[model samples]
Target: MTKSHDVSVQDFNDEDSNVSSNPTFESVLNARLSRRNILRGSIGSMATAVLGTSVLSACGGGNDEPAPGPVPQFTPIEKLSFAAVAKSLEDKVTVPVGYTASVIYALGDPLRAATADYKNDGTDADFENRAGDHHDGMEWFGLGADGKASLTSVDRGLLAMNHEATTDEKLSSFFLHADGGKSTLPRPAAEVDKEVNIHGISVVEVKKAADGKWSYTKDSAFNFRLTPWSDVELSGPLRGHALAKTKYSPTAVKTRGTINNCGTGKSPWGSFLTGEENWVGYFARGAADDAARGDKSVVALKRYSSVQGGASRHGWETAGTEDKYQRFNNSKTGASADGSDDYRNELNTFGYIVEIDAYDKTKAAKKRSALGRFAHESAVFGKAEAGKPLAVYMGDDSRGEYIYKFVSEAVWDAADASPASRIAAGDKYLDKGKLYVAKFNADGKGQWIELAMSNTAIAAYAAYKFADQADICVNTRLAADAVGATKMDRPEWCSVNPKNGEVYYALTNNSARRVDATGSQVTVDSANPRAYSDVHKAKSSPQLGNSHGHILRLKEDAAGAAATGFSWDVYLFGAEADASTSNINLSNLTGDQDFSSPDGLAFSPSTGICWIQTDDGAYTDVTNCMMLAGLPGAVGDGAKKTLSYTKADGSKLDVDTYVGKAPAADTLKRFLVGSIACEITGLAETPDGKALFVNIQHPGETTAMANIANPSKYTSQWPSNAGYGAGKRPRSATIVITKNDGGRIGS
Candidate 1:
């Protein structure tokens, strides 16, 4: 029911943006699973231990057969002690029995003291001074009582999070409008203005009270929101380049606002890095404009458009005649043949790693253009030492997209971690970097393809002629294509193992995969080797591609993150415990650990636990979206395994890919489950690792607009039903969880 143009990028995708001729990471497309019943069993008794010869025989052990022992877990991981949280379909958050989840911040919460309390009804306004909606990726920045940056201040700290779009259906954000808003075009200016306020990023100070209860400080000096109207400078390679200029910033030094902020990260120098995901859907492309632009521009534009149409995601452009709102319209396609006077270039300003100084709101946010951009999921810098070069890894959050790594031109200086100006430190390390995209080989090895103008392939490309390095940075997707990067399956959040320096990435499920020759359907390949059907078991939510995604990890050949050669493997394959085949359930997941669409991933800096969050549909019938805590293993713990499948014409195909050591209950277990229609997104933790912060996004998101009046019919009435917020209408919230006895989480 979701047309690509009618909803956000997460719901549907009608555009095949991957135009590369490289091998598509193919899998059989989709379905989801969920159930409320509990399946209690031991680690060995659970059906997850049945790893046939096709999966585990690759390690080349001394023995001829597998070890005669209980289901083996990753030996390097610490033994988990908490009982796995049972899957639940109830309209509330569920955690381990000993943990308490308290609502710390929620949608419409007052960020400033003067802002009135949120009525929880749709009439609320002034979101600029209040907490924005759909809280996604978040990071913890500790601050002292006096508001200076702190490394050990648990009582006072800043929670910098992204307000990733809104909970909307079709074109209208009904949840924010009193009369369920307008579902048609020429949307009311007032409605558009509210939406414009609810997006971008927010930095609020959260504190633990004397009574041990956690809450946000209403008037903290650290609190601020970067809305669509805020000023943001374009830095690095595109600082004053012509390709980055628009009518609003003709000189191209700056632009207005950031949107569609998704996953987030903490820079080495104590700054916040946020990825601009799926920002193209927000711009309106006029019909006539496609023909007016240069041929190369059209090629790049179409590849960037996930859902191409004249209609904007929200009708912000039609709301007014002012340039502020009209800027949302790429009508340059209709006016200037070359877009010299239009806002076409405005689109180029976005999709970069925007760095915000966590400690200083006075510093304007900068778009780090040196990091090649596409649908940036998030950018995580690897372990930084005193004199080594720093490498930041990113994933393009789209089907058949590429994973990227940017190595800084300057060597790391430990003193920069606490430099006088964190933003200046960002300028030193992030502004000049060598951007490279991953190319995974079938032989279980990968190379980083440099995305520079000096590269022969990019310099001599015929598809989209590269004018210079500045143009290449702006059109990063096309540049990645020209260099033939390995197309992955919706690569999402990335995390680095503090214990081993290995990097892990989430390849959230893809829906465009196929096993045979189908129009626009991807074929099965090594890195993305599964293309099975989920319809047989998950009857309610039939889908295409890898519905239950898997985790892929890489280890540098050398000890440093700057190494260009790496060894990689599929770490854990998400699946139902009852999965009939061993190929799909290679991780040996049980009911307590199985999940679909691994989207949000982070490793606790103090605990070394990989927290896996899900944004799923296929498995909703069985349980709500959830989070899993896992202990990671180093790369090469397991060896190559070949999976065989029969195509529609009865021809056999074999896919050889690297698999990691299978996870048992002791290594990976479900930790928390969210409410109805809610996605378990952003996560953060105290330095002590005793307090965990999680973002519950878009609860009751499927509530039909027709039933907006009837709270009983809404898919969910969360935080409200949990007695935390004011109204019965559900609100996205950040919940703080801690052990009842005050112990570390996921221990």
Candidate 2:
């Protein structure tokens, strides 16, 4: 949806609406940049309704003075051109006229010569040697002759991608429980094992021949898989913490593996950072589990939705009473003290950023807990200047969540970018850092409030008692609450503009922004100021929420990643192209450039081009999920636009805020569309910008369990019928796109 999609004024009659004119815009903007105002504005109603005091300490002051820094040399694209692909709901991949896309590898494909070919059927048994399902964030690293990461050699590279999760059981009929339902008793162990082994990350070698043709080397020694069954170590702040202790690792220094690995990043020292998201749902707590823990423990779990008595998503624990399957149970069941005899502490070990050495298969991946755990969308590092500490930006992917950043304590050395050991580099930096939450003020400025028990305010917070550094780090959300961090509308993947170091985030749609009758509302605020009816196909009830989410950009003070203060604005607003509204679709999108629920986002380092991908439920009836290429300008590129629409009472209300310059075909254009019932996510480009890799996830995911026996009932038969394979079932896969003339993409 674009700014002009709807003609009606926004309806803000909800109880939490702060649309009053009492404190005018100017008053709010010019007010002293104090911790109190920072807390109020950033947390919106959550802070006022909860925390009575806001000033954490004056340590991290609100210095509004702007800092200056060096400007980046962005590659110009004024003469670049490419035919925009038309939107489609077809069960196949579509690309621009001059660009061609081919499947590189897919779910269940064999990654080793010893394994048999994938049948695309439910009976394949070599999951340990096969590609995992639901391909997500990925990266390309140049490969050396010794099968290690090389700074150069773009033609031959190692591709590391995350296998986030599997599709609905009915869609693939692969490894899902029989009857497509959770079992109350022992489940089929073989199926459970396969499902567990198909998650985590996949590192495979790919090479582009002289003719520009790309192919994955099936027998490459560099090919490896890190699944839920793999052994991994714990590192950083929480490495030796008591909370990380489990039966499998009484030393509290190791864990089994990573799960639900989503968005990822390629580190400067040549390692992979895989984010763990939606991991709590995979663990189950017994019915009487709450009796075994303290109130603070329960509160922390509930904050992350890992409460006691919760049933696991797939009932993995029901597979058997053995430790292997029972580890999914977070309930207190052991006779031993500290809950180490059971898996109560298991959930805490899974939600951190896992660091992997894709170039060294012999090394074990480490879960870095010092980064602060939450539903991590992804972690993108900022420019590392010599003698300055490095900064890592991240977002929590949930409605009404907060944004965070971690600043390394050690100063950066350019030589470390090509270090002798990436793991050692990680230990020197990621092991010691300060985690901070964002506080976006009304004057287009933001503050990075530190989340530390050292702050008296955090220690005194009544919501959850803080014990020590580990407590604050383990329960990061509570620390954020005490500091009054800004609650966003489901902050997702973030990208740092390579040209200027500005950070951009995709706040996917939120259907619960207004004060609801049930009292579960996220009040509209300056950053998220819209609440209206976006009613799509289902008209039984008005979709009174932020249906078409927006992209927010921030410029660090002085253009430094570690700057505590910054400027910000909404870069673009999503809405329907032909809607009868004005300014609602701030980008002024037409059918050719329209999209919703912008999820996956990436800025090409070489071309300075921003790629936007969608995971939409609002526009699926009209078009399937898609990806678009955009050339974005710096922050504050447009003016404040106030939009109005008539409400049901015939009264008109206005939404006043900054909006980006209207996008045109040349600036923002559709690039590709995925199969039906699919989400287009996880994009990466070769450093030279010659080839682009896009992930198509969960095609035909909406198929009902009752339709499992009928392949004809599936909504999509994607890469299989798209010239990559010949199976009736749809599988998630990675597609490599390139220009026919062997030139830079989007050129």
Candidate 3:
């Protein structure tokens, strides 16, 4: 396939300038291709073919490329003690020297007077209205001295935790039945409504004492829960598109609650943006339904991955065939072509960043369409520059996906903070913006190719015809592909340095990558630098797959949002040093920092500190997943090294690499390790950095439901019985960590 051609350079001032002047594919073919002139080059089949050939050939001939240097090692620091002590016997949060932690809130924790106290034995009938399961990402917002929420206050605050998904089988005892599925049982609408109300987000007011310990107020007025069934509105380009229309809200401009809120983002105006990922898979559709709706195209089928052959995973489909359950189906079942008979447009309602006004509970949530539709991991904004458009970067989370960035149309305004101001800021800045996908070049330099509708190559794509700006925004991935964006290895959560504005992406593990082309192997590229197989037995079962993951970093051009060029490098490579010489442990990682699947990432603005957390099944043997604190220097702070590996065919492949390094003890230290059978995810800090909040998700996950009630049979009883039977079922929770001396974290 040839590389997508770049459009001609023109004056960037035309608001109505079509990135492509022609609307029809035939019109694009008839357009002139002026190679002699730098500004008007047209992209055709030849350009795409050449680009594909170059990419494949570049990976095939490994000898021509320079080899990366040897992995650098770091000193190991003393491991923190793993103590199982707290007010509750089930608590299992860990802390480094001079620090302590406490469980502030947990699954099913009550947030309002309407909800009853949590019955720790899983017998709570009111749990449907309580908090959901598996807390992931979170944020801290301060309440002002005047009793209103303030974005800048440093003391009293509200903690907004995302209740990602649920583990409960029934909404209440009344819904329980002999069969494992919900189809065998029936429940009241009130019960179903409660389940819906508990599945979104939990906002609880928390305050820090003079001693630096954080705790929730018993009757905090700001405490509230935002669930999936709540009413929400749309913002940005495709807000009122025909594809977004639904029965509940015919305008398609309004919908209900957020789902699969994995990672979190905060707007400059002080609101939280929760990303809805893996949402399409939640809906159920009939296999033969798409053909009836005129949306049976292969693209549409693959995009929605309609579950026509099976029922919904969470059993929400059996909640009654009312528009509620029917809305979950992406297949066409109705008689009309007006989207009145079926809920095929439901899939389009999600996948965008759902913005929430944390302070103003009355404001409706808005899904910002300008951010693009994909499996968004998180939306992180760079430090705002006066007169410069705001920069927001996101990762597509799926294997072999691309990272994207959106630059706002409006300049930064420091005075925007209230709910009204926040909405105004989003409308002026996020609604109309330029989106660009990343392309990592061979020479450690990368470029941001604009995926504008005006681009001629996008206008001519045969896969799906692009009509206007709405088409470009809704079908963003296709447009990015048309512009030649580099496919990466599971690009997950992204973090930008507050001081330097450099971007970092967590490229989680890809097991399909191959050392050499075999029928089952995935060919390695520059972006996905590692290819290896592992033989290990997980708690679930024995398996062979790529267990270790890596991190990639890029520096923006001249510290500006408009910069097209950037320098790139591999910040860290995930591996076990004892495994093989070819597996480079660049951080000179000991068993402590040798983590698999680096997921959640955050940087402290006060000290420029970087905290890395893990969500893995690979390195669980060494210990439960852990968290590490690092002081990152820059994109290219380490030396250019070379790496050597042997293919399955007994041939050697070598390539040049860049890996970061620092004193093992001081720079790359394993600050804490979690309890048994848990993944350490999510991180947040107080404004002064005096305290830190960490989440421990699904402890004792390996335990079977049959043995859940027996403490001796379970691998862990964290946050309940640190030693023996604590009666309470294991639940995920947010732990508050603070230093005894009241000093800033990582200081």
RMSD of every candidate to native, in Å, equals 9.7, 12.0, 15.4
- lDDT of model number 1: 0.79
Candidate 1 lDDT by residue in tens digits, 57-86: 101111121122331122233778888877
For 373-483, candidate 3 gives per-residue lDDT tens digits of 877777899878777889899988764567899998887766664446566667787888888888876557788878876788788876677777776777777777677
Question: Which model is ahead, 1 or 2, in terms of TM-score?
Answer: 1
Provide the clashing-pair count of each candidate structure. 18, 19, 36
Quote the positional error of residue 445 for candidate 1 in Å. Answer: 0.7
Sort by TM-score, best first: what order?
1, 2, 3
lDDT against the true structure, each candidate: 0.79, 0.72, 0.62
Q: Between the candidate structures 1 and 2, which one is better when assessed by lDDT?
A: 1
What local lDDT does model 1 show for residue 382? 91
The segments of candidate 1 whose C-alpha lies over 4 angstroms from its true place after superposition are: 1-15, 25-77, 306-309, 333-340, 536-541
Return the lDDT, model 2, position 101: 84
Return the TM-score for each candidate structure. Answer: 0.91, 0.88, 0.83
TM-score winner among the candidates?
1
lDDT at residue 92 of model 2 (Cα atoms): 76
